[model samples]
Structures are given as C-alpha cells and as structure tokens.
Target: MATDHDIPSPCPSLRDRKKAATRAAILDHAERLFEERGYDQVTGAEIADAANISVKTLFVYFRSKEDLAFADTWLIDAVVDTLSRRPSGTSHAQAVGEVLNQALRTLNPDSGGLDAFHRGFGESEALRSRLLRMWADYEDAIATVLAREASLPAPDPAIRLAATQLIGIIRSCTSDEVREYVSGFPGEETDALRGWIRQAVEQVDNGLTRFLDRTSQSPGI
Candidate 1:
C-alpha cells in the first residue's frame, strides 16, 4: 500500500505510516462492501477490488469476512498488552476490565465510517451469530492464557468455564448499557450496568478463590 499522503501531519515513522495506510485501506473497503451487501453476502474478491489490491494481499491482511466483524479490531494483542501493562497490585479482574474498556472505547459511536458498520452489524442476524463465534474464540484464547499465568494444567476446564462466564457477562452488560443509552435513560441505568459487570468479575474471583481453597484443604486434584 502507498503512503497516506492525505494526512497533513507526517506519521512518526515510515514503517508505521505504511502499515497504517495498508490497514486503513483494507478496512475502509471492507467496511464499505460489508455495509453494501450485508456482511455474509460480500466476498473477499470484492474487498480486494474495492481496496485496489490483489486478493492474495487482501488475504495477507485479513483472513476472513468475519474479521470485518469489529471496527479497528485489536482485541487479542491489545487486550493482552493492556493486561501486561497494568500496575502492580491491580487485581486480575480489574486488569481484564482495563483490557476490555481500552479495546471498546476506541470505537465510540461517533467514530466516522463506523456508524454504517454498526448499523450493518446490529441489523443482521448472520453478523450477530458470527460475532458470537468470534467472542467464543476470544474467550477460549483468554482462558488458555489465564490458565498458563495461574499455573493451571493445559486444557484447564475450570479456566474455560470462568472465561465463558466472563465473556457472557461482558456481552450482556454492554448490550444493556447500549440499550439504556439509546432509550435516553438516566446515567444511573448505565451505572447499574457497570455494577453488574463488577459483580460478574467479583464472582469469577470468588470462584477461583474457593477452588484454590478447596485444593489446599483436599488431598489431591
């Protein structure tokens, strides 16, 4: 991809500038095409055409139509990095909060070119189903990493269950908050939504604590 000469200010580094340009071009076209035909109806070949790149190059950037699932999606790496950057004494659940909040905030309702993307996603059952699958994938990855950090054995079923609950709570809470805001409810409604999220996080911690406590008291796993 060519440099983003349209921007008045120069990017800090040429490498970053080029990479951003390529990523932006691909997403711009992807979003447009996705909005045009509903996500499932759009093809990668169409995306490549819209982005003025080869299909191979487009595939190099994005693996699937499902990738257009999120606007400027950076969940996997960004969430991991966010968790890693938390200061000492930040609880694991709070670290999770920071990761999710940082990831979602970058795509606020006012973001340009995103309104259509949100409309497409919100109105399409196919897109919603695909998002659920992606969410499951994300939760599984998070659970695997959490298991490693907590020194649990591979394929830790407990970690997976906790991760599933966490993911479910997050999705439900966020959706409820969005519903409240759209309905022009008071800020307190959103506050309640957050309270529920905090409760969900606390429940995970409590469950983990109980598990460790039981293991300590027991003779074997």
Candidate 2:
C-alpha cells in the first residue's frame, strides 16, 4: 500500500559503508600512532602503513597529514545544521551554546581526541596557526547563519560581533589551559568545565542578546 519513496532506506549503501569504515580505520590508526609517537615524528607513509593502506590511498581521503589530525571538521557543518534546524523559539546565541556543549561531550578528555588536538599545538606552530584559522572559519560560518536567521539583507557589523562573542566561548573551552585541566583531572574537572560552559552561555545571553535585539530594530549598535 506504500510507494517506494514512502519508505526510507535503513542504512547507507555498501560503497558508502566501505568508505566510512576505511575513514574510521584511518583515524583510529592515526590517533594511535600519534599517541604512541609524537605528531611531528609521524609520516603520511607511516600512517598509511599502520592502516594497511598505501600513501596514495591515504591522500585520497585526507589531503594532508594535518587534515588527518582533525577528524571533527564535521563540527563546522554541525554548527550550520544546528543553527539552521534549531527550534522556532531558540535564539541564535542559544543554538551556538547548545552546539558547544555537544562538542565538549563529543570530544571529551577520555576520548584522547582533545589531548591530540592540544598536543599538536606544542608540536608545530603551523598546526596551531591552522587551528586558529579553523576557529575563524567557524566564526565566519556562524555569522553567516546568524545574519540569515535575522533576515538581514547583507552582512551586518552587529551580527558579526555577536557571532565573534559566541565563538569566543568555544575557543575558551578548547584553550590550552582548559584542555590541560580537563585532560589532567579527567573525572574530577569536568564539572568545573561544565560550570564555565554555563557561565559562558549566560554571558552571551545577557550581553549579546540585548545588543542583537537593539540592532535588529536599527542599523547599528
């Protein structure tokens, strides 16, 4: 009684599954090697060797060795999705806070992903600079979403400022000091980090929310 379009496929196709499995395998092996040896000490050929794939094949999935270090590049897309699909009553600042909280849970200290990300900073200035650029990219992407959500005809200074303030909280959470504290104490320090997360959200909700409201009715703050 149902048309073919009415029933969604339960899972990805075989090729997609194989590709995902291969990508996961690469990340798993890369993280292990990066943990055992330092990031600078590792090579693309070595990562491919560990994953049982050729260097050429490794390059197919990841453009560079640094690209392999960042498996959570999806967080950018996740932010865009979260903001775009957020509940009708949610403010842009509230949606950004939700994504940040989710990110903390996703890349918790126990996962070793955060530690690797932090360690890469001390290992290479290039990597650290790239990480900062990635944060800037997040800001720009979020600003675009905020402007669109506000129904602005074009980029607005007020929207950009709000986006920057919102993203600063995310940057603070991932700062070296915070990463060390969370990764060092593990079970004990998570609550403190959560508390900071709440405070950061409150700051934006208190400060930027009002600024946005005012600017929405006018040209500038």
Clash totals for all models, in order?
Answer: 0, 0
The digit string of per-residue lDDT tens for model 2 on 82-182 reads 88998977876678778766765777565544233445324576677678778889899988887887787765888888888878877877787776766
Candidate 1 structure quality by residue, lDDT tens digits, 77-99: 66556555667767556667665
Per-candidate TM vs. native? 0.63, 0.79
Off by over 4 Å in 1: 1-23, 32-46, 54-63, 70-73, 84-88, 103-119, 123-125, 173-196, 202-208, 212-221
The stretch of ten residues in a row with the least summed lDDT in candidate 2 is: 113-122
Error of 1 at 18 (Å): 7.2
